[model samples]
Target: MTSELPPLPDTPPPAPTEPPAVSAHVPPAPAARRLSPLAAGLIGLATGAAIVGGTWAITANSGPDAPATFTLKGSFALTDSVVPDGNGGCGGTRGYDDILEGAGVTVYGASGDVIATGGLGNSTYDGDTYDCTFKVAVPDVPKGERFYKVEVSHRGTVQLSGKEAENGDFGASLG
Candidate 1:
């Protein structure tokens, strides 16, 4: 036997469409104001001048805080095959402490406790040329790692102390 079912409903109708409207009271958009060529050029020149002036000020205004002072002099004679000390140097041959007086020189840790003490000596090169000797013996410098400093007192005062490599080498740090 077949059972009866209800019938389907019809689709709804479409709605009406209309064009968008504008308001007569609203004003039109304004154009951007353009700068004159002369004005633009002057502005660019001023900007460039400002940048250059800033750069000049920065470069020219560098202050006077310089790094530490150190100097070393020695005979590089191959025949005088004097290698450096335990720190890769050796020189009782010829070296200057400080041409200027009060030039302080200090050597830190080395092998023994005996730090470097400075003094004057004399050396004879391959020829009969005599050389001035400035020596320093470190009294308590550590063996493997060491540090030293050589400072000059202002502009005068000669330093007769720093006569060894551990004393000073342009502020070099030894390992």
Candidate 2:
């Protein structure tokens, strides 16, 4: 059997076509990689120098009574395994040769004289808790609540100990 084919329809009119648009705007710049080694080193050196210079400047120009009494308080664990004197003696056969545990207090006197000093043995008394209070008085002071710093040191000797102390105020205040 032969199959009959359908006739094609009449062609419709063509639609309009527009031209592509163009612009003259500049492109954005590409991002840069990490800084060069030389640049990084210079920056690091500059930062270190600035820190050192600032520290020196501050220390050199402190006024009288700038830092007063440095009060240190903290608990220290004895490494010797021997208890404390229970009488603030900080007793040990070692004769307290080592700081074992200590609190550092930095004080400044009037006249722009800065002093770094600290205290020792701030811990419990005979197994009982104790508040170690160490005061490094700054001489020739004008008078006011002065600023101070506290540091603790643990001995590397036979004694395995630790200590703690806190200032009445922050580094900017007395205590």
Candidate 3:
């Protein structure tokens, strides 16, 4: 006896109706937004203004705490016959000792208030010019005054303009 096998179907099988079990359905991401040219420019301008404002505030606050100052430096010369004191300094008669080292140097402001004080350095005798020169330096003198008055060792004050005092271009002379 002979047995007959059934023939295969002509069409292919159908696709699956349900999604895969491993992954869930997700929506597409939205596109990135961009700022307009005018918006970008405004933002930059605002940032720059903030920085400038901060800097101005800092400088303004510090101005009062530490006022502007300058060093008042000049020479006080006594035109007299002086001899060398063997110590590389000048020596003169009584009452002339005031121009030597440690002499008080005072700087007065426009309102007659003392701004700063220092002392004279060693005296140098210039025999050629007959001048005993003493250097004076009054440091940290407050600025912004219309004029400055400098006095050395109780001597009469020498008036100087603000520009002259700040530049240290003024000097005192006594005969």
Candidate with best TM-score: 3
Q: Where is model 1 more than 4 Å wrong at Cα?
A: 1-24, 60-68, 71-175
TM per model? 0.25, 0.24, 0.60
Q: Which one wins by lDDT: 2 or 3?
A: 3
Task: Give per-residue CA lDDT, model 1, range 1-175, as digits (tens).
Answer: 5697776668766576676676668777798899999999999999999999999899886866544333343222223323233433233323332321123344333332323333222222323322222322223333234443332222222222333543432322110
Q: Which residue pairs in candidate 2 collide?
A: 64-110, 64-111, 65-110, 71-175, 73-165, 74-164, 74-165, 76-162, 76-163, 79-160
Estimate the TM-score for candidate 2: 0.24
Summed over model 1, clashes come to: 30
> What TM-score does prediction 1 earn?
0.25
TM-score of 3: 0.60
Model 1, position 28, has a per-residue lDDT of: 70
**Least lDDT summed over 10 consecutive residues: which range in candidate 1?**
151-160
Off by over 4 Å in 2: 1-70, 83-89, 93-115, 121-124, 127-175
lDDT of each: 0.38, 0.42, 0.83
Ranking by lDDT: 3, 2, 1
